[model samples]
Target: MQVDYEVIIVGGGPVGMMLAAELALARVRVCVLERLMETTPYSRALTLHPRTLEILDMRGLKAKLLDRGKPITTGHFAALDTRLDFSVLDSSSNYTLIIPQHETEKVVEEWAKSLGVEIRREEEVVAVHQDQHGVEVVAVGPNGNAVLTALYVVGADGAASIVRKQAGIPFIGKNSTFTAMQGDVVLKNPPESGVPSYFNEQGLVMIVPLPKGMHRVVLIDPERMAVPKEEPVSLEELRASLLRILGDDLGISDPFWMTRFGNATLQAQRYREGRIFLAGDAAHIHFPAGGQGMNVGLQEAINLGWKLAAQLKGWAPDWLLDSYHTERFPINTALLTNTQVQSLLFGSSEFSPSVIALRNMLSNLLQIPEANYRLATQISAFNVQYEPDREMEPHVLNGRRFTELHLRLENDVCQNAYELFHSGSFLLLHLGSDERLYDVIDWSKYKHVHVVRASLAKGAPDWHDVHTALIRPDGYVAWAISQSESNPMEAIRKGIIHWCGHV
Candidate 1:
């Protein structure tokens, strides 16, 4: 059947744009239908976690974001005072970039456009339908409604996803029992020094600087906790919240943006339903704690992007398409739990002395480096690991996130391994001098895989025993063949066929 696009993405947020770009990087024909003609003005999601920075770094997009955002070595968990330290991570992109959501969306969108991704703004997708052959999306715009067809459709739409509903995917979670308010404004009498979160019987409040001449103030006020999320927030409301919690407004004035959000957490029963798939807020929604929402969505985009591209390009194994849900579902499940846990700490319902004491205790525990590192890895998403496929060679590196490796080329020049992934090709990195497999596997057939024979320039303890490794497009170790293997060359051949397709 003829399709308008290889993939049609609904929603033009960061996740949708990122997925579109990733697919386009592989030369897949893709389109994005968005309701807004322009990017959002407000800085919605404030921070990009460490793992997200790593993903962007692999694509060579991290430098642009670094130019636009502030980098912080620390991240928050449940509004704790000690803060999770990201500097301990072993990568150049270790710090969290405190860029506004708008900044992130624009970067991904520009990259997508540069790659020839067709984005139809001011077009809202109303419904999605799919069968064994293909999927169709109904969109409404100023020009009027139109139906678009594609081999696959992805829903990057928000919490109230029409795609999920149309596909009959159950959204499992509870309604919000409480809400929090935040605003970007000029803090006339701002705190003199460091920005710290305040938690007391009055309320829990956090204020951070934004990109423009504005500060983002977020707090869970006890008195205003039960207000519906749909209600509009006013400058007086924020001023009142400040006075109630911190005793002074910090000379708050000149409101730029204000809104109320709730703790209504939801997750899709499944990320994929036949030809239609879900990503970002369509897959899961949680209370905005630790600034992890948008970061998680962007991660999902990368995970799903290359797989979809592979499927459309006809190099994907049958199981490759299904692996997207298998891999990301559990990660997001933990994310939802983490947000709910943070919601409890934020005093979603009761703000009593005990809750205050609990927060203090956790904060103190985080001061210990071990405890801090444990939570830091989880919050930064460095802890993600997928199980190795049964057909592949078994190794510890299988399914683990690929850390940046300093590699020396055959010509003796050295460069970072992440630089090789910018083209979105599977990297067949043969660290040892085994070239017999090269003759066994026809190089012309596996055009989608980038085979590089290089040695580790710098010592990476785990990679020391690796004779060869197959790295996925999204920067994850798919298979690592140990030098100890008696038949290492054969394993390398199977690993390539396992991921890059038998063709």
Candidate 2:
């Protein structure tokens, strides 16, 4: 069968929609098939970390989310007393946004639609078969069962991912040994201090104010810790847990949404299988610790989207597509480990004195500047560093996340560096305008790469003395050439071939 599109994404949640929008932004023809006719009103995942905001800024979507979300300068680690101070992180968006999942999804879905993505709602993909040529998908929709083909298929579906199962990619991890309760409700007597958190032998309980005079309550109770995640949570159940743990539910009432979740962590053996790939929860899942579940998935969408588009457009280097798995797998592994650790600290191991003591020590340690910054980077996902290309001249900036840089263009007009990535293309930023740059490489042949001749408008210690650098569409530095290099222009030529060319 003829390929219906370059890529067909199965699942149209925030992750799927973000990926589709990225592809469409790069001029890749893509479609999304989702089982739900509308976005979920339940806001299970409500936090967007800093790195997530940075990537969204790249696509000009950050401003939209900013308008909808409330920003907080701190995040939790095991519901510790001293939280991770995101304000210390060196980013414009060095904080988590307290926006509900429904709001996030709506912002992304509108983005996907604005970019011309064909979204087929109420379409459930039952079977996905991929061969050497392409992938065939069978889905049931309102019209009837239908078959469609695409050069590649991505499963952004959550925990019970049909695409991942059909691809036969084993999801390996441990089953849940304990669970916790979460709810968004109206609190007649809310926390006086705005956001109140308490951790003790009784159990951990935190309450944060939400929009529209509502409050989000999350708690772990020793008595109900072993309840199966499938068991539904009720308002009465929350009241009992609060009275048992916090001695008062802060007058908890009128739950807009409530659910029981477990620490059953898992990750796909590999993110890709032949012509099929996995993303978001389809690739990995963990307990809702540090409010990082949704952020990690959104970041993955940014990482995978451009690489797939590059391959489809024929300018992607041979190894580019496979690098998606190589780069993301280990990161998810670390994510699962951190979540497990957080779960253990949340009294999953035992709601006793020992865990409480350990958590107290860690929380106190986090008050120290050095310790706080390290955990802040990890939870905010600012610590991610892609392995650099060894063949290129070694520079400290290589493989590092390209944080915001102010550049003075050839015309001497200064602008923030992120504006270059609006179209989701490789950015060959030539900091020093050596006229020999164009003579060394045929820039026209690499039309997909956006070459900018500019110098640093602001004094950046790490970027000082850099002749040039190549940044991947996902905002990671592909490679950088040091000013110490004897032949910088020749290095730029090789870097372009190593990244921007299909060969």
Candidate 3:
């Protein structure tokens, strides 16, 4: 069985392209098969949460993204009046970047192409067959039918994934309960004030400003809740919904794009089957509450890409590849749960008095700093914590994202911690005066790990007490130790072997 590529990714959305770029960064041969000949014009998702921005920063894409989108310091939870204050988050990028999904795809596509990823557009995957050695993918394109073989195949296609269906993976979840409409339209008489959100006895409506003069309007009309998804969304329908929700229609016209969606929530029973795996909408779908769909998919790609590349590269631990599902499934489950709750909170055509009281109570609670911070962290994904391997006693910082800190390298250059991860490799940062820490490990053996001896700058109180730490490529602290550790060298060796594998 000769493999044409190390990996073949079905669908060239943000997740697929992100994984492809990551594999390419590791010099793995990868290709993306997409059914669409070009990028989508419609912007389905319009915001990148805080954690997502931090991930992009690790790869040096954050600046470019910031240039294209506006950064809003505050976000909302279930459209509540109390704002989730992103500015209070403990990361360099603590704000949500309001960039369109289309622009996001374009940026990731360009980055993937630059990394030598072979993206074959207009190629639709029809059938997938896998054996112990490799997986064979049958795709139909403009030219004809072709079979491509790869060591591994990942399905990033949307909800109606052909790869997932052909693989016989059960997508277990509920169907749409209520339907809603969304449109990007030019408003002749736009509301002169804040983002308008109305929830009453009739339905829910929200109007947000877009990049151009267009406004994005979302409406859930109980009367039209039974509207079939296949039916086209007309300007008149949007206008009528607006009039019903608001006193006036706001003069919406010349719609750029319009579509209908539902609150159907689903998650794949498993993320991987043999050599074929799932990601993005192929793995899970829920109501677009909190604007988390694309962000979660992108984060999933980040989690899977490095592990898959490590397996192909032959340095991966036996449990490394499987940990992808072990680590991400719980997060996806939580995401589904929260979105379902939000659907119940906002998807209704009318809010009962009890529901209004609940909303008011919850909003008041969010006004409390701790309560707001907790929910904000969850929504922004800043609170994601993976379980550390039980081989050693866990440090509090272990399995958590390494807080961004400034470091003064031996060469006297000062930089933030994220700059060290731009190369997508493990960083062994020694934050003490003991240069002997560098001699504890033989550098020649671990080619993917870089060792840096530096001292913490003046104001990193979170990391000031930490003498040494090993940070993973994904920007999480694999292991850390305070100044009081008895056997620092031995502990460091154990941590390295546990995380990076042995020489």
Better of 2 and 3 by TM-score: 2
lDDT of 2 by residue, 1-503 (tens): 57999999999988999999999998889999999989989988889899999998988889999999899999888788898899978789998998988999999999989999999999999999999999999999999998999999999988899999999999999988888898999999887864668887788888888889999999888888889999999999999999988888688889999999888899999999999999998888899888887888888888998889889878788898999999999998999999999888888877777877888889899989999999999999999999988878778998999989999999999999998999898898998878888787777787778989999999876888888999999999999888889988878888889888834
TM-scores, all models, native as reference: 0.98, 0.98, 0.97
Give per-residue CA lDDT, model 3, range 1-503, as digits (tens): 67899999999999999999988988889999999999989999998999999988999999989888888887777877787999999887998888899999999999999999999999999999998999999999999998999999999998999989988899999988888899999988887855667776677887778887788998888778889777889999999888887768888999999999888899999999999999999999999988899999999998898889889988888888998899999999999999988888784545677777777788899999999999899999998999975776667888887778888888898988888888788899888778677677787878788888888775764575787888888888888887788888888888888778776
Q: List the residue pairs that clash in candidate 3.
A: none
Candidate 2: 10-residue stretch with minimal lDDT? 193-202
Q: If both were scored by TM-score, which would come out higher, candidate 1 or candidate 3? A: 1
Q: Which stretches of candidate 3 lie over 4 Å from their true place?
A: none
TM-score for candidate 1:
0.98
Per-residue lDDT of candidate 1, residues 1-503 (tens digit): 99999999999999999999999999999999999989988878989989999999899999999999999899989988899999999888788888989889889999999999999999999888888899989999998999999999999988888889999999998878899999999987777655578998899889898766678899899899888999999999999989999999989999988999988888999999999899999999999998898898999999999899889888899899999999999999999999999999998867899998899999999999999999999999999888886787688889999999999999999999999999989899999666685786898988888999999999986899998899999889998988889888788788888888889
Worst window of 10 by summed lDDT in candidate 1: 187-196
lDDT of 1 at 163: 88
